[model samples]
Target: MSQSETPSLYASRVPVFPRRVDGFFRRMKWWIMIVTLGIYYLTPWIRWDRGPDLPNQAVLLDLANRRFYFFWIEIWPHEFYFVAGLLVMAGLGLFLFTSALGRVWCGYTCPQTVWTDLFILTERWIDGDRNARVRLWKAPWSLKKARLRLTKYVVWALIGLATGGAWVFYFADAPTLLVDLVTGQAHPVAYTTMAILTFTTVFMGGIAREQVCIYACPWPRIQAAMMDEDTITIGYRDWRGEPRGKHRKAEGSDNLGDCIDCNACVNVCPMGIDIRDGQQLECITCGLCIDACDDVMAKIGKPRGLIDYFALQDEAAERAGAPPTQIWRHIFRPRTIVYTSLWSLVGVALVVALFVRPELELTVAAVRNPTYVTLSDGTVRNAYEVRLRNKHGDERPFRITLTGDPALRVTLEGTPYEAVSVPAQEMVLQRVYVTAPPGSDPAEGARTEFRFWVTDMTNGERAHQDTHFVGRGED
Candidate 1:
């Protein structure tokens, strides 16, 4: 092929300037953006009175201490099952939403979508609407363009920084961290994380926008598996709006469909694709196109719903002059019901586990180097390392005891008593010696299985760990 005739391997990106539109879905988007952003930025500042010893932040991931605090609930490192269960519930919830309403999460609640919408709003405020943005794009570089561009970029950067700042606050005491960050006294990791998140938020939400949803995200491809014919998704009714024409009073206009080919739907689409071309991966099902088309239909004196949330199963029935299926039937079907049940099951299980867990925990490991030591006093001694965990907010005395043989005696290495005081929200290790009287049956036996129990003196909560108590074997 000639050099000129050879097609270019790459196609440059076409910037999309979505036109501003006002309707039911538009208002819904506005409200959702406000609620989600408000929750994200303000949650870290909500103080929970979790005693003076514990963190005061309502929602915090105390990585250094290996604890997760959410309001009244505190999760220890060993209780990671709660986090795993929550992740499972999140997956199930996503599946349920996708099965019921295709890409609803992507459209409204996805962080990418929400931030992109915010950026677009900022851009619209700084630079006029769609047509003005298009004109500015095409016009030669000027001081006016530079001023608008610089202003928009500055605003986007500030929003990105705030997003990053809010995320870091979840990992520490918000007020303390904020002060440290401002004074340059915070850890380097904190600054590094915030910088990375800031860059990504600006690049993905402000610059990449639709490209992130169409390419960077895996959900759009995976969504096909979750969706079915019954899934309600935004779609164009080509059956009713075909043979599109603009002229209404012309001779051939009588045969024309409701669509005037005005491209209002396409103009308002953030993804910048024609919805009338049928379902595409780029479509987020945001319903902005629906709002745009409905407005156009109302103005043209035609019935609405040229573009609307539709189920593929209803296409044949509607084409044959039957009324569309009820939305409830599509949403409450077996697939979505199963997903909802699983999600709720996981959530309930996590709550039960969180409430019923013991406040005191014990773990014991036998020191096996010499197995059993023959003490100078003619006693068989088995040493063990025991860890006592106190989950309460205040220090509590824990009474240690063993269950196996009545002849066996337990003693902590440094202390003469069987009780040790564990600090609040801390685990303490101590050397424990289990001894049997020299002439007892347990002293001569090769091994005796026993459980070490730690009882909290304050609340009587108990935890136990099982281990083997070695003895002198018979020759």
Candidate 2:
């Protein structure tokens, strides 16, 4: 092929200026944005009384201490499975919603959509709505353009900084961290994390905008597999809208649908794709186009629903002059039932595990260096490192015992058996020694198994670990 015949590899981005529209769906988006942003920014500041010995931040990931606190629940490092289970349930929940409602998460709850909506609102306020913004983009740089651009970018940067700053509060005490940050005494990691998050939030929310949803987010591509014919999504009724022309019905044009070809749907779309083109991955199913078209239809005296929430099967039925399917039937189908059941089961299991899990844990590791020694008294001796955890809010006493060998006795660092005092919600590490009388363990060179048990003295709850007692060989 000649040089001119080959297409260029790069495609320049086309800017999308979504015109402002008001109706039910637009109001819903506004409420969702306010509620979600409130939760994200305010949750770290809420206080919980976890007693004087524990951190009071309601939602905290205490990484240095390897503990997670969420209101009344505290998760130690050993209980990470609870976190994993919650994540699994979250994924299943996404599947359930997508299978039933179609792109609802992307439309209403996605961080990208929420932040992009926020950035666009700021842009519209500063630079003027759709037509003015488009004109400004096409116009060459000037003092007015420079001023608007500068102001808009500064505001976006501030929002990004706030988003990043709010995130760090989840890892530390919010009040203390705020003071340290203002005084420039916070840890370097805090600054580094905030910087990285700020950069991403600004780029993804303000500059990238819809490009992140179109090219970066995998949900739009993956959602197709989850949606079926019965799944409801925002759609253009081409059967009732096509054969497009301007005021075709007023002109008494034959075989023409109700559509006036005014382009209101395309004008209000954030993704810059025509919804009439049908089921593109770029569409977030935001339903802004529905709001826009509905207003236009109401003014033009045509029955509403030129664009509306419609299942794929309902489209065919409507095209064939049949009534559309009921919305509830669309929601409670077999696929959605299965997904909902799986999600609910995972949530229930996590709740049960949280209630029934033991409050104390014990671990024992046999010392491997030289394995065992034969005392001068002809007894077999083995060493171990014992760790005990007290999960309660107050300090507790525990007694350690040895079992599995009648002739075996346990001691702590050569002292007689005594109760180990473990600090509240803390672990105690100590050295332990186990000795067995001569001929009690096994024949020379053999190993005998035993148990190290720690019983909480207050409640009599016990946690035990299995270990082996090693004996020396004799020639």
Candidate 3:
């Protein structure tokens, strides 16, 4: 293909040896690493008071119980839409952020990038910096290189194992599971999960690295569509840096461009791209290049920011005689506003729903096969399958009150009030019979509303359901 048809910065299939950097971006990356990794390692150990019968873990996905507990909210299987809604909101929020800032998530919050950087840091610390690592890789295998590589791999393996072990703790009681795991008594599923997570962690963090961001991930493709010229991204000031020339020992050349032809920016880039060329699909907009270039500029006695996070629109305006305009509008555009409003509404609705959720529910189904039976005593009796759900964590005694009319009398064939005790988190089916007063008919072939009021005796929690009372006619 022609150069015009091709992209500016072509993707690389080779591995990169990103040199260690010490600057603002590096420190930001360090803090992100610490906070994120700390959360991952420590959250499983945090305890929550979830009554006596339930697990005390602060966050747990109780798959066996079909329940999800996070701090205080207890989600039932039917409430999966809460999770779905949150995911939708998260996706929209990501879109909004990407529209405003290019690939910032990949730089800061992406788990793959974070973990890979952590692993790389560990490798660099244990073995050596980029140059030393490259030398070790090039040299024939020796005892020193062997020992260093062996130690690094062993540590990497342990880190991967720890990552896997922490994940399954969210499914079970962490302390108990830890003991069980050590004693080799954990369930088969726990072992299975740990193994799978370990494989993924080692493969992704230790091996795949930037390939995940470039080839495996779909985010860059999505972001390409979402981003605009006003989006602030890491860019090289080509106007200032063009006509790059070699730096002299005394820095005496007036014609030399400000860049000084130093590859410091390229060395610090985790994705291994030269920013001086232009904006690129491979750039994560990490600002590390800016930091690197700034340090280089300081050494060369030039003002910093030869490379920077810039908006294309502002650059273009500055390139022309026109005054530069404010460059960011993606964060608060119509799409973002709509996404925020809907996301907030869903969050508020879920919270309210959780608060007002009932402890029990009632369901009534009229016997449709033979709808009603007329006894010889001139009383019309209706049969219904009443199902009561005790959604609480303890056995509940529910009083079923029937409401229709004053003349309407209720007589259960064997039980009174249709009252039945249901076990905790269980449902019970009962055959209920309703009969009107003697010689009194609601109406021929008509259905009257029958209401069932379920009140939990223990907590005074109440639930109600209304259904039709089938009679010979309208009742």
The model with the greatest TM-score is: 1
Task: Tell me the TM-score of each prediction against the true structure.
Answer: 0.98, 0.95, 0.88
Q: How many residue pairs clash in each candidate?
A: 0, 0, 7
Q: Considering summed lDDT, which 10 consecutive residues are worst modelled in model 2? A: 439-448
Q: Model 3: per-residue lDDT, tens digit, 1-475?
A: 6566665696556667788878898899889989999998999888998554777888898888888888877777777988887888788778767877778899988898889988999989986888887788888999998899889888888888899999998888899999999999999989998888888888888888877787888877778887777777778777777678885555556665787777988887888899877877788887788888888888878888678776788788766766655543535667656767877887888778777777787787888778778788767778878788776767777777787765455555456654578887667887777777564546343767768677788878777778776667642
| Candidate 1 lDDT, 101-214, residue by residue in tens | 999999999999999999999999999999999999999999999999999999999999999999999999999999999999999999998999999999999999999998
Question: Which residue pairs show backbone clashes in model 3?
Answer: 443-473, 444-472, 444-473, 445-472, 445-473, 446-473, 446-474
What lDDT tens digits, residue by residue, belong to model 2 across residues 338-377?
9999998999999999999889899898888868877898
For candidate 1, give the lDDT of residue 259: 92
Model 3 C-alpha lDDT versus the unseen true structure: 0.79
Task: Please report the candidate that would top lDDT against the real structure.
Answer: 1
Q: Each candidate: what lDDT?
A: 0.92, 0.91, 0.79
- Score candidate 1 by TM-score against the native: 0.98
